[model samples]
Target: ARPDVILPESSLLNLDGVQDAKLHPSLGGFQSLYDEGELAIVQNVGYPEQNFSHFRSTDIWMTGADTNELLATGWLGRYLNNQYPNYPAAYPNEDVPDPLAIELGYNLSVAFQGPVSGMGMVVGDPEWFYRLVNNIDAPVPDTQAGDKLRYVRLVTKQSQVYGEVIKNAASKITQQGGYPDTELGEQLKIVARLIAGGLQTRLYMVSLHGFDTHDSQVLNSDHTKGEHANLLATLGDAVRAFRSDLKGLQIEDRVVGATVSEFGRRIISNASLGTDHGAAAPMFIFGKHVEGGILGKNPVIPETPDVEDNLGWEYDFRSVYASLLSGWFCTDSSTLQETINKPHEILPIINPSVCGTTSSYENLYAAESWVRNYPNPVTDVTTIEFKGTGKPIRIDVINAQGQIVETIIRAKVGAGTHQITWDASRLTSGMYYLNYHNGAIHQSNALMKH
Candidate 1:
């Protein structure tokens, strides 16, 4: 939804013949990290049959279920369950004295709920957990329920071992300063401290809310000085500080952070100066070991846009998960299939050098299509000519940075030669790719606009 951060060269003048486009200026930290090769942008990340409902979409993302499927267990929960089958019954042993996953908040996300019991623990802090366990002073009834209550209290008290472990680890090192005072910053600071303190936790989850910007997304007087901008600034600053803290702790390469949203905003703004729920948005992944560069093509802003028009996705969100499982965690194909329930193409998000040996994989990104844009160096306009199979066809203008600057066409055409006029007068002078795709056939033709 933040085009300035993803597609910095996209022009509103070209789409609507009105306002000019520019970077939001609130994303300086992200820009700096990207320029320094610590961040990679994944474009048009979504799943098929995108349901716009926030609750449903969030469930789909958390549980890693298909749009029409219902899943009770989360993706990571399934993985952890598979990895540690003796969990809950035989945890906190000599080899596993710490929580497998930790969520730095009060309520644990559904993502950590295992098929049987929760695969992780959630706490605001070490003291918080201790106080919760100690504050249970209610009297129990003299019946079968009393026996159940006693057992539950005993189990709760036994879990306090985790609290002691967390306290010991956190006391090992004071956090390296530079984290923003924001909530996300504090949460990430705790994560860094825990990891640095020798906690064997493999997964940590933290969250930042208020992204449901239905109104007042931007200021009328200044488009970049409102709710969305403030959130972005918070995110950018907190993440930058977290990265610095990780580097200072010498754990930069051991951790990777990524952002996920339920859905993206529409391409068009409403009367309240905010965008509505839409499909397909960009995702950001950052770490020292990440292959820092843009992945997949940029989203295509359509010509003659309408309120109903939303960005189409290129890479599925499952693909990103698959990459992490394969590239970062080095999980086997059986694990991948069990986690995501399907095979998805693995992107080069993680550095291959770090992952010395990996299972054989496939690329599901695109196929070859026969298409060409005439007039190599067009100063004003160019003609995109291609043959389609009477199916749905899409043509996008992709810049060198892999951002889709403009969409030339997206429609069904007859099986014959078709030519569409693309006005590139408003586009910057640079090398671009005219990408055409119709189902299994996809291709990109180089176009130079002077």
Candidate 2:
């Protein structure tokens, strides 16, 4: 059987800008592109307590317990390593060793580095890879036959075998139908082809970089529409295309795709009108098995400037990871907790049983409604607005999965436009929902805490 998972880098799960009418027009056609897919806007997957500014200052990316204790071994890596120990030994020559181990300085990805012969392939530019693999030459032995000649033959044989494997893989991919031209897009296409070809690969890894949108992030004429938008568009197209291609091959149901990033940017716009390093960003999960629609409580950005110039964290990120591990992968919650070195309640697993079923948005009371946030996908303090007859009003921040992170207000007030400020000076950049309750009625609106 093929690997059931596909993980990519730097992906945004639920962006409000992509959903709004005014903002949608700005994103080209990417808006509403994946509205029907199984979408989970995971809030705060990174450590919220740590100061990211200091960490980024030193260029120390991915240093949390979840990242470091795993020793550069990602959750997927650990899974692979556990499943196949001899996997590293399958790379043609015993002397060559697994490239993952070599690249990470002998520390293997937790998912792929296992005890058994874990068969895998690192998909890249086929032409470049072929050129590098086939053009290798080693000095011939001084004598016709000896220890030297035997070693040379062994090396040549291994190279030839691996070369043939690469060529076959590339040829098969070329002959297959439907793939995008972008890097990650093509990589995914290759992944699909491999799966269709019955490669028996259990874990597939690909990446999409260039998400650090520091300057010129707006879509105006003078300033360039940041790279983030283009990257996301490509990602959306690639994923959708991959899904379609999978359907054509009749294996779409067996595959699941996930995306993550190192961290999200601050809530407030920087001097350059761009975002800087901040805590807790969003994560996305897409597949036939995923429980569709928004989940979790949305976090609210205080509409006041904080001393640190950042937004507050509403949801802990580990909850999302726990959901994926326990729900999608069928791993025990306790085991996942131990692996990530953090203990949080496991979110309700998103399985086929719950797919397509609509869950109530946490604050769905009927009667008076209040809206304290506007222009979601907010770049600064969001103004919380309220409406309805005089009643006690309470505002709460919830993540995508319907988990409440913080309560902004919890008191009765006269019906009118009372403003609550969300200064996002301490939060991670991600999508969130705002819920307002006035005892008798409830209203909820989607907001982006980026």
Best by TM-score: 1
Error of 2 at 22 (Å): 10
- Residue 139 in candidate 1, Cα distance off native in Å: 20
Stretches off by above 4 angstroms in model 1 are 1-23, 125-158, 362-450
User: Residues 1-450, candidate 2, lDDT per residue (tens digit)?
Assistant: 001111121222444434321222223223343365445455544443334544441122222243223344444445545444455556545554223321111222334433343234443353335453455444555675666786875775566444454445445544555666887677777667656754444556666767666765554442324455567667777777777778787777777777766567666666554566766565667776665444434445555533243433434455555555556556654466444445444544366353333222112333234575765667877777766457666677765333466788888777567776776545566555566655424445667776
Encode model 1's per-residue lDDT on 143-191: one tens digit a residue: 9999899789778767666877877787787648687778888888888
Q: In candidate 1, which residue pairs get closer than 3 Å at backbone N, Cα or C atoms, i.e. clash?
A: 298-404, 369-442
What is the C-alpha local distance difference test score of each model?
0.76, 0.52
**How big is the positional error of residue 176 in model 1, measured in Å on the Cα after superposition?**
1.4
**Runs off by more than 4 Å, candidate 2:** 1-34, 51-73, 85-121, 124-126, 129-177, 219-224, 333-338, 352-450
Q: Alpha-carbon error at 105 in model 1, in Å? A: 2.0
